[model samples]
Target chain A: MSATESVITTQKRSIWAGGMSPLKVTYGKLMMWFFLLSDAFTFSALLITYGLIRYSYPGYEGNPADFVFAPDKWWPIPEKVFEAVPFLHGVSAPLVFVGIMTFILIMSSVTMVLAVEAGHRMDRAAVEKWMLWTVLGGIAFLSCQAWEWSHFIHGTHEGPMVAEGTTFFGANLLQNQYGPPPFADLFFFITGFHGTHVLSGVILNIIIFYNVVVGLYDKRGHYEMVEKVGLYWHFVDLVWVFVFTFYYLI
Target chain B: MTMASEESKTIQVTPPDKAKIRKIWMTALFLGVVTAVEFVIAFTMGASAFRTSLFVGLTLVKAFYIVSEFMHLKYEMKVLIWSILIPTIFIVWLLLALLIEGEAIFMVKF
Candidate 1:
């Protein structure tokens, strides 16, 4: 043992020596993972901030069944505020629209994973088909968000009075008919941030889809790019699960 | 140039596995069912600590499926899994601290 140790000591070895993929993943994928970790922190900070602000507000102490929407209430019930559905005026459908939106996102995520799976097999035709579906799904989800946002911004038909002679018609940065100003602001910020992610994910998917159609990945002999983008897409879906829980459900 | 070629060589494109595809759809179905359950609870049940906790638990279940199955993190190396999961604990801690502090502020101000 001593002779071998002396021989090994004579030859220098550095732990910092490069040329090894320790995680058994490509450099691009590893970087994406780290970027996602940092992005996770950013989102966590936003959500935790929302939780803190929500906690600071005094919620309704009455029975949930007897609850009604009042302008003076500091913390408005989510179901009451988000009751209206598209094309169904004055309908008391709580969480239904958001549920549809969630379903769309999850379906898109499924299509995305299918695309990645198709990529794994180097099936160009299948990849194109699934990627197209995934892209369409993303566009559909974004369209749903736009409709929801417009609906939220325009607000209900009642246009309840917020103050003396000041009828609140809709929500904005300064004021809203629903709860507090922060509620509207956080809704816009968090959902807007998430919407931006979905938008970017769609654009990225388009680019990758274009590349796939153009036979770029085929020429390159690999489709790891799709897998990387799939990671980001899945992360977006993951974030929505929590947002649905926090903003809509809780 | 050699490194690029060597890397490509190590990356093999295998035929798609039917079992794996079935697993993906099954996970998706699980996510959809959990979400539907959340919707049902949102309507059927009223707001309370228990209801909130139930929703949160179901959300974690959905998150687990998305991360593990969709993201394929479950098949990754152990070190990679730990590296991602460990940092998330601090986020939970932040939530706890700020919630407590927020409640205190409300108690004092209101």
Candidate 2:
């Protein structure tokens, strides 16, 4: 080859190498991590706000252990108020359902990790399978959360005593049911924000799943998409860790 | 034509070993056991100071494993690790400061 031809060939080779190189990381995954980091701040703000509200309003009428919703007074005990379904009626399963939701999210995170691993191996089948599981897990968690929301919204209220936008757990802020006005407002705001995240995650996972099935990522010869979604999924799981702690355990 | 052949060669490589798969499963199982312990402690133990401390401690343990293993931060560069850790520390500090201030405001208002 002529000297000029060799130089051009080398340049072509370098460009080819760059284009063909398997991406160990992708811009999408990096951006997802950044998104999760910002989301962490949002949740931290909400939870800290909750703590402040709870701490300042100490010695309200009801016991934190056995709290009941009274229009005049009472802070709804996290345990008493959150007892929910799939554990059957008359059984004290407060926080149990939320606990299950936590587990589902975490397990799905595990599946996401597996998908990333599969991506590393270039194992298309494994990626598809695990991504499917992760998607299903996200859906299951959203369903449980939706049920929890409905239960909160339509809580037991009797005639004459019943008030608009008021539920059995506590008094509504926009309207009064149980304890103070801010209680319901904070509950809706915090949990609503988290639910919105779960919704977006579900949508994201579905997109990733579609990408896997259609072999978009396989053609690109990188599974960084899976890794990025894994990061996001894990972040969602981590936020729940704090939620389970401060909101439920503490 | 040459580039196409090179790409084909790379694509045809075999999968990783079963040992790696086994290791991944073991790590996942360990995470599961840790989660079960967390559940037990949260449910069975009374809401005492000690229980609270223990719960927080176990949660940190679980968080560490999830971040290091599942998120593959262990094999990553120190710069990456510090990048995540430093921000997280600042966030916690911010949360504490804000929480205290918020409580004071609430006390004044209520």
Candidate 3:
């Protein structure tokens, strides 16, 4: 490396090694990875705890695997229970909508990656376009989640014969159409926590999107901000993979 | 140093290479396909013991991609990898043991 380049690299290393960087990454990129690692542990703890609880309460009913339209002694299957949309009555899209949401988030993550790539290329227009797409993706995912939560809360009632200790939204801690307690409680707690993460991720994307538009990172010279956010965005997507497997699939 | 000036100075640094950028995108595509396959397996297969095993296996595949590629742990230092992995293994073992014990307690109570 040239003298100036070598000096810059050494200075960067020392600054990061000593800590006290606002971005936490002397490279800005490495700090994002560290943050993502800690975040992974958080999601892992929640998911593994969900698994423990799920296994402990086996055969309670409302099997996510084999769901139906109406509630029975068996738990409403996950696919069946979460198969409707808000205000779109009589449309049965079991897991289809959530699947779409998943793809959307994944695609947004792809766009974010591309933006990071563009940042690396110093292609200002490309970065701007992809960042905009990424932000849109986040918003779309959030909207879908909102619809899902609403559908879950305002569940459809079939009969007047109320099953004591049974809830409209399948088995929950408060009560369920099937299964024991802790099932619903765990479901709410785990999925709710993940939803909150998605919400924060959306907010962060918006902030980054704004920054990108204003040419904050472009003027500064490095696209590490994009890289950092890209890590976080991917991490969110990563958490969803586990959640989909444990909560819905298995 | 003042925060504003420091921030400005940091922003002045240039971006990385095009090859690294392309690598990230290619890795993401791979992750996407793996995830799709996971969903397909989960949906099509029956819940037999073997199927469950397969599902777990696929889940692991997806997890590997997310950790190694998306999270870039694969490129990280060996010490970093071991530090994370070892603790994760211990935690998983502890969780399983506790779950088994917890189940036993539940059976006794209920």
**lDDT of the candidates, in the order given:** 0.88, 0.72, 0.68
- For A51-121, candidate 3 gives per-residue lDDT tens digits of 66555554434444444433233333466556665566777766777777777877887787788777777
Top candidate (DockQ): 1
Query: Lowest-scoring 10 consecutive residues by lDDT in candidate 2 chain A?
Result: A157-166
Instruction: Show where candidate 3 strays beyond 4 Å.
Output: A1-28, A60-76, A85-88, A157-173, B1-29
Ranking by TM-score: 1, 2, 3
Clash pairs, candidate 2, are A83-A94, A170-A178, A171-A177, A171-A178, A172-A177
Ten-residue region with minimum lDDT total, candidate 1 chain A: A13-22
Tens digits of per-residue lDDT for model 2, B1-110: 66644554566435767887777777777766776787787667666769867877877877787778888777766755676677777667876887688679767966
Q: For candidate 1, give the lDDT.
A: 0.88
Model 2 lDDT, full chain set:
0.72
Instruction: In candidate 1, list every pair of residues with a backbone clash.
Output: none
- What digit string (tens of lDDT, one per residue) describes model 1 on residues A1-250? 9999999889876533666776788889988998998888888888999999898888988987776555556688888777777888877888888988899999999999999999988887788999999999999989999988998888888546676677777799988888788889999999999999999999999999999987778768888999999999999999999998999988
Which candidate leads in TM-score?
1
Candidate 2 lDDT over residue span A166-234, tens digit each = 334423556445445666777788888887877888898889889877777756887787788788787
Q: Give the Å shift of residue B52 in candidate 2.
A: 3.2
lDDT of 1 at A52: 92
Ranking by lDDT: 1, 2, 3
In order, what fnat does every candidate score? 0.73, 0.34, 0.28
Q: Which is better, 2 or 3, measured by DockQ?
A: 2
- After superposition, the stretches of candidate 1 with alpha carbons farther than 4 Å from their true spots are A1-16, A163-165, B1-15
